[model samples]
Target: MNFDYKLFEMINQFAGQNQILDQTVMLFSKFGPILFGLVFVWLWFSKSGKKVDNRKIVLYAITITVFALGVNKVIELMYFRPRPFVTYAVNLLSDKTSTDPSFPSNHSAGAFAMAWALFWHRKRIGSVLLIMAFFMALSRIYIGVHYPFDVTAGAIIALIVTAVLISQRRLLDPLYQNILQAFRKSKGQKYYRNM
Candidate 1:
C-alpha cells in the first residue's frame, strides 16, 4: 500500500505542471478506449478486401474485452477497493468522480484487451495501440483515479484472457463463424463484406 501510494504520488506530481501534456493525457484517458474500439469496428466491417482472419481477430478481441469487463465487475462486487481520490490527497487532473471499486481498472482491462487482440493479427497497428493502451493506463493513475496495482492487475487479467481466447480457437471458431453467418445474413452486409 505504501509503495502504491508513493508511485501514485510520483506519477500524479506531473499532472499540474504542463497544461498541454496534461490536457492531452486527460482527453486520451477519457476517450482513448472508445476511439480504439471504433477503429476496431471500422476495421472489422470496412469493405477493404481484407481477409476474414483479420475480422475474426477483431471479433475475438471484442469478445475478450467484454468478457474481461464482466469479470472485473464481479471482482469489484466481491472486494471493494476505493479510488485513490477517495483514499488519499492526490493531484487529480480529470473531473471524473466515481465511487467504483479501484482494485481492477475497467479502462486498463479494456485497453489492454484490445491491444493484445490487435497485436495478435496486425503487428504495426497493434503495437501502436499497445503503446496507447499503456499510456491510457498510466493516465488513469496519473489523474489520481487508480492505483498502480489496480492497473497492473487489469493488464494482467486482460493478457491472460486474451491468450486463452487466442489459444482456444478450436472451441471459439465455430461459435464465431455462426455469429458471422448471422451477421452476413443481416441487413448491414452492404456496408461491410468478405467475412
Candidate 2:
C-alpha cells in the first residue's frame, strides 16, 4: 500500500523473470562484504609510503563501519518493519528469510560506511567502492530482501555517521590509537604501527 513497498515490489519483480540477474544479485548480496574487506586489506597492505597514512585510513574505515552497524541495530529495534517477503508472495531470490526487520538495511549501512571511509583516504578507490556499494544496495532489493527506503535510509545514515566520524578525527584518532597500542601489546596480528 505504501510507496516504499510499491517500489520494492516493482524492483523485485524485475529479477523474478531473469534467473541470471537474480543469481548475480544474490551472489553480490552474499559476498559483497568479503569483497570490500579484501579491498580494505589490499589498501592497507599495498601502501608504498605515499602521503596518505594507509594504516590509519584502514583503521578508521573499520571503526566507522562497526559504529554504523551498531547504530543500525539500534534503529532496527526502534522501528521494526517486516521484510517484503513476509507480507507478500515475492519471488524471493535470496536465501535470507523474513526474520529480520526491513527498515534501515544493515548491508547498505555497512557498505556505504566503508565506501565513505575509503573515499576520505583516496578518491579513486573510494569512488569505485561507492559504486560497488550502490550495486550492493540495489542487489538487496533485487533479491527481495530490503525495501527502497530501507536501503536509502541505511545509505543516508552511513553517509552522515561516516562523514561526522571522519570529520572529527581529532576526537576519534586518540581512541583508535589507544586501541591500536593495546592490540599491539597483545602481540596479535602485527601491522603498521605508524598510526
Candidate 3:
C-alpha cells in the first residue's frame, strides 16, 4: 500500500491544533460501542406506555453483533494488513498504541452495526449514531490507525450485515418474541400480562 505523505501531514497538522478532537476520537473509539449497546439494553427493558417490542430489539442486537464479528474475522484473516503506526516511524498527535489488525477496523464495524440496528427502531437517534460512526471511521484514518481502504471495507461489511438482518427479520421475529415472553414470565413482570 502506498502512503500519502501529504494527506498524513495535513491530518497531523489538524490533530496538533485540535486537542479536543483527539480526545473525542479516543473517547468514541473506546466507549461509543458500549454506549450504544447500553442504550439498546435500556430501551429493551423499559416498561414504557408505548408498545416497544423487546424481542425485536434483542433480535436486532444479536444479529448485528454476530454479523459484525464474522465480517471482522474474515477481513482480519484474509487481509492481514499492518497498521500505519506499525509500518512507519512517525510521531502522531493522537496516542498511537494499538495492537489490533489494521484492515477493516472493528470500531467501524461495531459502530455501524449498532447504528444500523437502532435505525429501525429510532430513526432520529440512529441517524445521529450513523453520523458519529462516519466520523469515528474518519478519525481512525486521521490518526494513522487505519487506511482509507480499511474503513471502506468495514463500511461495506456493515452494510451487508445490516441488509441481511433486515431481510431475515420476519423469520426471526417470532423466536425473538417468544424469548422475551419467556423472560417476562420468569420475572413475573406485569408488562407481559397484556401479551
- The worst-scoring run of ten residues by lDDT in candidate 3 lies at 49-58
Candidate 1: count the clashes: 0
Report how far residue 69 has shifted in candidate 1, in Å.
Answer: 0.7
Measured by TM-score, the strongest candidate is 1
User: What's the TM for model 2?
Assistant: 0.88
Taking all chains together, each candidate's TM-score versus the true structure is 0.91, 0.88, 0.83
Candidate 3 C-alpha lDDT tens digits along 60-125: 866886788787998688768777777775445446477679887887887778787777677887
Native-vs-model 1 lDDT? 0.87
Best to worst by lDDT, what's the order?
1, 2, 3
User: lDDT tens digits, residues 58-146, model 2?
Assistant: 88888889889999999888888888888888878886595889888999999999999989878998999999999999999988889
Give me the candidate number with maximum lDDT: 1
Candidate 3: where are CA atoms >4 Å away? 1-13, 47-55, 90-96, 190-195
Weakest 10 consecutive residues of candidate 1 by summed lDDT: 186-195
Clashes per candidate, residues 3 or more apart or on different chains: 0, 0, 0
Candidate 2 segments exceeding 4 Å error: 49-52, 177-195
- Give the runs in model 1 whose Cα sits over 4 Å from its true position: 47-49, 188-195
